[model samples]
Target: MQLVVARIGRAHGIKGEVTVEVRTDEPELRLGPGAVLATDPASTGPLTIATGRVHSGKLLLRFEGCLDRTAAEALRNTLLIADVDPEDLPEESDEYYDHQLMDLDVVLADGTEIGRITEISHLASQDLFIVERPDGTELMIPFVEQIVTEIDLEEQRAVINPPPGLIDDSQAEVASERDDA
Candidate 1:
């Protein structure tokens, strides 16, 4: 089983229990005992859940090996993950993980292939996609239903209807100006 859940933030307490910034919608259910958290391929170690409780509406977790303030502090920026069952995910057809969107080809409404998605950034109001074109130009597109019309994950392509002045030929000139500045 592959672990997909990301540890967004840390816990706040004195008992070696850290708050987990859950990536999944169901945080309460997934932070149960015996859940394994793999940090990386080289650091893929199990985090035995000593106890889990909700404090101030956040998931507070205590691992078996971590039993002190220093131990919990060590995990301040660490990520927690567990094996996810694909069937357990939400049935929303439009929803996709950021990892799944990476490397997807971005195309305009007129079938002009713009770029490939390199990253997804979060803004105060919406998510933005960083796309890298073949010409090495990077375009920042707002990821909204209004602009993104279709996402074919199997084909690894995203069809977008960019807003006016977003992808015009003059946009390159603006980019060059910014680079010069």
Candidate 2:
């Protein structure tokens, strides 16, 4: 499988270094120097990483054959893709990649069908699973331990333990009385 690991940002200085917005969790392994990555535009790459550094908390990478600002600027907004094997799983048992979680059937604890995970939206606070329901409507489910209880990769399913009102407003309770006497 091909995973987008980073997006090339603006050129960093006169050198061929370009700032990048990292998309992968394992940057050191994927973005390390001498790592050859495929590019999105196809014609721009496959580019080879000559060097990488962290400057001002941002990752900067210099590609081989790109020796100046102009050359680096040409790669701006280009996506860097990394080749990955389907069987190559994460070392941690509990951890999973976004690609691994995608397309899994979402179900309730008793195996009630909810939806299918279409996208994983990474937010500043928490990740959200964009689920497509059987009725063709989309539902945003919080990807938290309190809600998403289990992930059965072998079965290709995700079991969620949703609280009342989480699945539908009909299951939610509303106030029946007010104290504004």
Candidate 3:
């Protein structure tokens, strides 16, 4: 299993140090020195981390053989990938990798089938699940604890307790339904 650990940003200085936007939770473990990572273009790497540090709250990494600003700048926008075990769980028990949640059936707390998770979108602030319904329609649901109540890997299902107007088209309709009941 290959996971994106970081994305190379612009060159920091005249040295080979380049800024990196850390993607993985365990940056020290994933992007530390001596770690070799693959690249997105597949030709730019595998980049071996010669040195790394935190500067101005951003990760700075210098790859072996990249000795100058020109060499570091050439790696801008390149994704750093780490090879991990398929069964490797995150350090945090509550967290999950994107692959773990993919293909899981999505259901309401009442067991109403909504769809199956087709993709997990990692956004800036939060993640979203792209669910495809039985009819081929799809919906994007925020993968927050308040909405996604439970994830049963063995059951291969995710139980959602979406707020009003989330699964439904209109919040008014959902409110009215509650009133009628």
Candidate 4:
């Protein structure tokens, strides 16, 4: 599958180069000459890299055929993707990709299956796990070491001890009060 690594922001200069907001953790390894990138959900063409360099912490990219400001401007907001082999990804014992965590079963410390992970959000302070219950209710659980005790990626399960006043019943009551108001 192709994973998105960057998005074309704007035309950097008149010479076919565009500024990119990098999404990958290893930007240096991903951007280089002769690299192939696919623009997702918009242009269907596979963009072949003519040149790439980091300028002021952002990636500057020039496509093989794209020349001049007009051609480069046309690619604004295009997501750059590279074909990724799942096996090629590094295995961190505790850390996991957001995509891998999504839709995994979320169980409590005592072995009660409460929900499935629907999304993983990165906040200013920490990561948040959005778990969705069978009844369609969503719980925003903070991904803290104390709360999220264990993550078994091989088993596709996360063991969590939810903080006080964050359970399904308490959250539902809070939602109900908001609705009533």
Best by lDDT: 2
TM-score of each: 0.74, 0.89, 0.85, 0.76
Task: Name the runs in model 3 displaced over 4 angstroms.
Answer: 118-126, 132-138, 176-181
lDDT of 1 at 105: 96
Q: Under the 3 Å rule for N, CA and C atoms, how many clashes does model 3 have?
A: 0
Clash totals in order: 2, 0, 0, 0
lDDT of 3: 0.91
lDDT of 2 by residue, 21-90 (tens): 9988799989999999999998999999999999999999999999999999999999999998888888
**Candidate 4: which pairs clash?**
none
- The CA lDDT of each predicted structure is 0.75, 0.92, 0.91, 0.82
Cα RMSD, model 4: 4.7
Clashing residue pairs in candidate 3 are none
Against the true structure, candidate 1 has what lDDT?
Answer: 0.75
Give the better candidate number (1 or 4) by TM-score. Answer: 4
Greater-TM-score candidate between 1 and 2: 2
Model 2 ranges with Cα > 4 A deviation: 173-181
- Assess candidate 4 and give its lDDT: 0.82
> Over the stretch 80-137, how does candidate 3's per-residue lDDT look in tens digits?
9999898889878899987788899999989999999998877889999999999999
